[model samples]
Target: MSKEEQAMKGLWDMFKKRMWLDSFRMKESLMAYNPSEIHCIAYIGEDMDSNVTKLAESFDMTRGAISKLTKKLINKGLIESYQRADNKKEVYFKLTSQGKKIYNIHEDIHREFKDRDQPFFNQVTEEQLDVILDFANKYNTHLDAEIMKLGIKMRSDNL
Candidate 1:
C-alpha cells in the first residue's frame, strides 16, 4: 500500500482503540448506569421536550429501544414521565432528583476531562484548531454516509 494508505490505516486503528478504551473508562466512571442510560439521562436533563421519539431520533435508535431504556430509567428512579396539560396523549421525560445527581456527576466528569486537556488546546493555534475541526467534520460526514450505505446494503441482503 502507499504511505498515505498506511498512515490512514494506522490512524483508524488507533482511533478505534482509543474509543474502546474511552468507553471502558466511562463505564467504570458511570458505575451502575451503562453509557446509553447515562446519555439518556443527560439528554433528558438538557432537553425540555425529551420523549421516546426524540430520544430515538437523537440517539439513532428505534423507538422500541428508547422505550425500553426509558422504562429502565423509570424503574431506577432516575427519570419520570408526565404529559403536558395541553397534551394528555403525549408523554415526556424529565430527570428525577436522583437522575439530576447522576447528570451532575456525568457533567463534572466531562468538565474535568476537558480541563485536563486544556493545556493541549491552549497550545494549539487558531489556524491549527480550525484545520483539525475541519478534518474531523469531513471525516465524520464521510463515515455517516458510509454507514448509511452499509445499512442499506445489509437490509437489501437480508431481504
Candidate 2:
C-alpha cells in the first residue's frame, strides 16, 4: 500500500519472474532431457550414496515419482541400478557413460552461465555481495521452515 511496500513487492515479483525465465531457458537448452531427469542424473553423479529415498528427499518429491524417473533414465541407458554388497535389499543408482556425458553438459552449461555473469559480478562490491548472500541465505532458511510446516500439515491431514 505504501511506496516502500509497493517497491519491495515489485522487486520480489520481478526477481521471481527472472528466475522462472532463466529456468525455462535452461530447460530449452537441455532439450534432450527434462529438468527432473537431468537433476536426478546430476545428483547421482555427485553423490555416491544416492538412492531413490535420498533423491526423493533431496528433490522434495515422492519416492514413487523418483522411481518412475529412474526407470525412464534406465530405459534411456543413462543410469543403472546396483545393490551394495553390504545391503542387498536396497538398490542404488549410478550414472552410466551416457549419463556422465549429460552431467558434463549440464556442468558446462552452468560454468558458461557463471562465466557470462562474471563481469557483472566482478563489478559488485564485497559489501553488496555480502548483502545479497545474506538475503539469499535468510530467504532459503525461511522457505525450508515453511516446507517443514507444510509437510507436517499434510501428514496431519492424511490421518
Q: Give the candidate number with the greatest lDDT.
A: 1
lDDT of candidate 2 over 1-159, digit per residue (tens): 999699679878978976676677678777888888988999999999789999988887778888999999999999999999999999999999999999998888778768877898899999998997897798879867987888763331142
RMSD of each: 3.8, 4.1
Task: Indicate the worst ten consecutive residues by lDDT in candidate 2.
Answer: 150-159
Instruction: After superposing candidate 2 on the true structure, give the runs of residues whose Cα lies further than 4 Å from its correct spot.
Output: 1-28, 140-159
Model 1 scores worst on lDDT over the 10 consecutive residues at 150-159
The residue pairs that clash in candidate 2, if any, are: none
**lDDT tens digits, residue span 1-159, model 1:** 999799689888978875776676677778798888999999999999999989988887778889999999999999999999998998999999999999998898778768866897899999988987897899889977987887763221132
Output the TM-score of candidate 2.
Answer: 0.79
Candidate 2 local distance difference test against the native: 0.85
